[model samples]
Target: MDAPTVSRDFDVVVIGGGHAGAEAALAAARVGARTACVVIDPAAIGRMSCNPAIGGIAKGQLVREVDALGGAMGQVTDVAGIQFRMLNTRKGPAVRSPRAQCDRVVYNREMARRVVEAPGVEVVAGEAIELLVEPGASGGSRVRGVRLGDGSEVLAPAVVLTTGTFLGGRLFAGEWEEAGGRMGEAGAARLSRSLLALGLELGRHKTGTPPRLCRHSIDFDRLEVQLGDDPPQPFSFRTGRLDIEQLPCWITRTNAETHRIIARHADRSPMYRGRITGVGPRYCPSVEDKVMRFADRDAHLIFLEPEGRDLDDIYPNGISTSLPPEVQEEFVRTVPGLEGARILRHGYAVEYDFLKTHQIRADLQVAGVDGLYAAGQINGTSGYEEAAAQGLMAGANAARAAQGHGPFVLDRASSYIGVMIDDLCRVNPDEPYRMFTSRAEFRLLLRSDNADRRLTPIAEELGLVSAEDGERTGRKERRIRAAVERLRSVRQGERTLEELLRRPEVEIDDPAIAAALEELGLAADEASEVEAEVKYAGYVARQAAQVDRMRRLEARSIPAGFDAASIRGLSNEARDRIARRKPLTVGEASRLPGVTPADVQVLLAALSGGR
Candidate 1:
């Protein structure tokens, strides 16, 4: 498809200027491609609509990956954040996460400013109405450009659709409903219609956000205060240290009085009644739903979190509800900390149109469509972190696909990005999906602190990060290698690197390694990497061996056109999954929800054309 005028208007055009779009545009542009971002409303750029925070549990792992690959979430969050806390201090390194509360306004501005300043990136404010698909000689439609709301259009080889919750979005609270995507913004009326016309199958998903209370009005004296860790960790590897002063979050519990009050308004709740059609997230249940379902339970913990420093709003984390205004007011006053609390913003649930991600391939591209990628809330996922993670992966993969290469898929057992992509493309969810530590089977080797080590090589291969990022990671690796060798060589009363690390008492900043590493010409930062390597040596080695085994399966070709159903011994689940997911490799097939050991053996048989 040769262009008549200004051939190849841009290399990639990212729609929706949220986490995913930002990452997509940045990755494409960073890779030396002319990139453009089309956002519906520039005012909403990088808006932290639900929570004024980022990174939690496995979600923090993704943020570091974004930072390692030169995405801006971590760097921006670090600067604009008012509070920083490293969660799960008592837990192992794999489960540890860094969370922070930010001034939402500042976060949006900083993210926008960085993206606009990035080389080869352009920002446009408008709604993308339809995708332009030019046909190939073989006959499937190939994406050529996208049409905007104002009857204008731009051509690009690739288009990443990171449309968050704007597709047929409806907000509900009690019996009242609104037409906007969010309470304040308008929905994307044309985009979803165009998708349906393009034969894209879509599903409905819902997520509820709790109400914000005026912090000054709350009785903080009645609640316990939760503070951040003394020595905090930053989300991005590129960022040096997190030294932000922390804000205190209050904790209170809802008593039987609160439960009874909510119970009386159960029917008025949009969830219990037939008002809402989309499936709500199971983990973040609404207040009315919680009270009715957990009838035996006496109380539920509520975290009173500040929206940001000098802000009056305190977000009621555990009290998400869509109850009537009167009932909400009544139940709110019953909680210990919120006895005199006033609602700054009412809690409401959103029902938005999302693509059932099983329809998307591991690259985040549509199976039959060329250069069309979708990410974020549209992918049937919940939480800002989950959406941002998917957005970045989709953006990176779309850019790769446009370059005539295969999808940029990171294999599972190596990075959280791999686990997330695999899960989204394979598992069929009945509700909005959120990432939990329990979701990843191999999380022991994929800690948030070591994301740069896990993905720097692949990121370099993808041409997203500069050589400096890779060199930094490589130098760190050399330090680890040298220490590993030194440990192997020194086996006397003098402590080995690995042995010293195993003694939790021997710190990473110990003088012995610092002197030895200095003598070996390694920098202090590089020495720290060696320290982590020595500390987690046993677990890392075991995981690497497992990764090697998985790589074999990942490479074991399941032929492009293999038919699993015809195989004599294949189980129904295997056959159905094989037909549905069409996993590019046996490794991917194994990662699907229910393909058993026997199923793998049968799949191998089928891969040989069922001879």
Candidate 2:
């Protein structure tokens, strides 16, 4: 005697409503797909489980690209942000990025509202216990939908898994362990087995957060106050102004004593105790890792960030740990301003299952499984921005696949999203993958200020952007072109205005350049973009030529199921690697590990019927 299974239908079914799932569902619905987002709790959609902030370093460029593609992250960040600052202001335009401190609760609520109000999207409360699969036309497995914990099914042609850290998640602090993604939320215990049953390879990754401090307990007088910019820049291109009241974040440092205490009790940490086998993010290491790796440094800077305008908890940006509660308290008290701080919640590490990147195609579709996609932490990425970008692409591609359309793929030259996906597909990261400006070879063309210029037209053609937004982008482009043309035409005593801009001393706001730009009625952002283009025109052209050369290789398609064993002169290592990766293009095959330049030349010769 079992309960009857209640079956429902949707064009696309998205599992987990975190940052990735929310974007997936929204993007699917935006493309006119009947989408359903299944989550353990509907209220947790877009929850900032790690930090109460969005966009930092290379991450800000990602948010702008997501916005240009009509994704909700940048707009939602603009609405929920409490403080905004443009990082790397003194550096060149290529590395300058926007960061925003947000109200965590408000961000979650606003993102959930967007998902709920989105047409053709239904938010369903349930844990996905199993993936419903059927025999594919090619005698392989294909995902048909998902089976919820209640023995009900949401049937769809496509399924997207943006499970974050919830799939077989285990939280650890000292000797205590629990089956949960976050502190209070339960993990999807059964989902990992379902993926394993499909013959998908899974790897483990660990990430930790710092303890939240009771704001009233901290001594504000001892801290060095860091204020937001006077005219804070917005993350979203559509956001006209930031009218919210900005708050100040404070900084303190961990002294030698703090490091000593952590070193003394390091064995109590789950990671140190040999209880956690997963590899964590190397860029954002835990406190114990930091101390052990950089023992030469006696102090590490910590920023005390506000969680929200109405909340009393402060998030310490640095010193994330999984030490025992008492040790956490003891080490935290050694810091300058936190001498008497009360821990609202103790930090802990969570280890979860993620699919090996090589199993997914460029469009995020599972290589051997049809109608199945994965994004977010499930794909071994670390940040919310990376997750959202993948989710947008996955959801849009899923919808298109369901409508009998070809896959929509982005190249590394187009945007950061493209760069990230290219890296993920070409290389299997051993640790959690995080975005950085250095990761892109053509970073000069991938600046944060010009994401809209780089990607808006493609998004509009894909039906991800509104006609009005598309027209706005077109108008901005025209103005920039006209301004550049005018600069080239207007000559100074010895050089044109464009030539003056190329000089290191002359800025966009210089008297002569400012007057000329003002005549064209260009906004501050547009004028700045013009300046960057004029200044780096030569470098940009060189990179564009490199991109063109790469595109020629990418255009040479590698037929599916093509056997590398037939190609003579390939090294055994290259043959084995190519066979396992199954690269879809000659360009991808060239980028695979162990596949040398000689190997690429051999591959080209074999494909072209040459020696």
Candidate 2 per-residue lDDT, tens place, 175-259, comes to 8999998989999979999999999999999999999999999999988999998788889889998887899999999999999
Q: Which residue pairs of candidate 2 clash?
A: none
User: For candidate 1, what's the RMSD?
Assistant: 3.7
TM-score of each: 0.90, 0.97
The predictions' CA RMSDs to the true structure, in order, are 3.7, 1.7
Whole-model Cα lDDT of every candidate shown, in order: 0.79, 0.91
Error of 2 at 44 (Å): 0.6
Q: For each of the candidates, give the backbone clash count.
A: 0, 0
Q: What lDDT tens digits, residue by residue, belong to model 1 across residues 431-520?
A: 988888888777877777667878888788878788988998887677668866775565436756558767888765677655555557
Q: Against the true structure, whose TM-score is highest?
A: 2
Q: Which ten residues in a row have the lowest lDDT in candidate 1?
A: 1-10
